[model samples]
Target: MRVAILAVQGAFIEHRKKLESLGAECIELRKKEDLEQPFDGLILPGGESTVQGKLLRELEMYDSLKEKIESGMPVLATCAGLILLAEHLSNDEHVYFGTLPVTVRRNAYGRQLGSFHTDAEVKGIGEVPMTFIRAPYIETADEQVQVLAHVDDRIVAVQYGAQIGLSFHPELDADSRIHEKFLGLIADCIKNNNCRKN
Candidate 1:
């Protein structure tokens, strides 16, 4: 399977390395031209949501990427990526993709010093390592969205259809289960012929 990692900004390289280790072809989506290639899934890594959103539009890749995602392309969005996909933000007025019916609170865990790591049982995936660095957590989700995992009563992971949004960075860990689970999602799409373009 091939996956496109948005490298415009943030911790994208780590995701690429993880996906690569799982035997998936990884592509970096940096410019609009990079979208020309066929990819089975997309990964929106952790980063500053506002900056990523601005760059996506300014680089003219926002519309096309949004279109693909809306067309049922499976996505694994982490940290700020969760912010990007949310339809609502608890503190911000701007919404990026607005594809997932979730409401997230940016920096809900305080600043960088608040960063932490822990092992949590992700529904359907068991316990896995989760690293949060100035991350945002989901405050509320539509009825259709499934809550995957939580920490200290705070929602940290959620799945809505073909998209999975996590408030923690899974790529920074040694475990590949999270990334593997994502590939399984893509594999399912392929088997069911539900993949968008590839």
Candidate 2:
């Protein structure tokens, strides 16, 4: 299975390594053309939301990405990546990738000092440690979005259909279960699509 990590900026390198450890072909997305369909799945890594927004505008992947998600492509977004995927971002125009049905509060956990580690019982991964660095706190999620993990009574990880978003950095942890779970979902979707084609 081929997996692409949006490497415009952020912890994509770590995600690539983690996914590679799972025996998947990992690709680091560097240009708009990299967003094309047929890749098994995509990963939007943690980074500064505003910066990513500017990059998306420059690269011209914003609309294409929207279309991909709408077509049921499986994705996993982390940190500011989560903020971008949110439908109602608190930052207005700064919000670029509004693909998921939710609002996001950027830097809700504060600055770098807010960077801390905590443990949460992820539904598929069990109790895994999460590293939150200036993470966006989820304000609301659609009914279809399943709350996966929480931090201090706030939703930190959520899953809506084939997409998953996290308010913390799963790549920072030693655990690869989260990425494995996402890859599993991607594989299942690809298999179903192939069956339909046949």
Candidate 3:
């Protein structure tokens, strides 16, 4: 399977390494033309949500990428990527894609010093390593959203349809379970003919 990593800004290279290690052909999406490439799934890596959002629009990649996500493209969104997908931001006014039906609080865990790591139960995945840096936890989710994992009683992970949004940076961890789960989602979408083609 082939996957597209939003490389406009963020820790996208880490995601590429993880997915490529899983035997998936990976492409970096740094420009609007990159969207023309055929891919089974998309990965939005951890980074500054504001900067990424701005770059997406400036590069004219915002609408196309958002349309893909809304149209059932399997997406694995980490950290700021999760923020981009959220429908509501409790602490911030700007909303990016707003494809995931959940509310998130930007930098809910404080600043860089607040960043930490741990192993937690990620629903179907079981205990997996999670690293958070200026993470944003889910404040509330729509009824259809599946609660996946939590840390310190805060909602840190959730799934809605083909989209999986996480507050922690699974790419930073050695464990490949999360990325594997994302790839599995892509496979399922392809099998069901729900995944979009180029």
The sequence of per-residue lDDT tens digits that candidate 3 reaches over residues 1-198 is 999999989899999988999999999999989999999999999999999999999999999998899899999999999999999999999999999999999999886547998888999989998899988999999999999998989899999999999999999989999999999999999999999866
Instruction: Give me the displacement of residue 197 in model 1, in angstroms.
Output: 1.5
Q: Cα deviation in Å at residue 153, candidate 3?
A: 0.8
For model 3, the superposed segments whose C-alpha errors exceed 4 Å read none
Candidate 2, poorest ten consecutive residues by summed lDDT? 189-198
Model 2 residue 70 CA deviation in Å: 1.1
Q: How many backbone clashes does candidate 1 have?
A: 0
lDDT of 3 at 121: 95
Clashing pairs in 3: none
lDDT of each: 0.94, 0.82, 0.93
Candidate 1 accuracy as lDDT = 0.94
**Clashes (N, CA, C under 3 Å) per candidate:** 0, 0, 0
Q: Which sections of candidate 2 miss by over 4 Å? A: 91-93, 111-113, 194-198
TM-score list, all predictions: 0.98, 0.92, 0.98
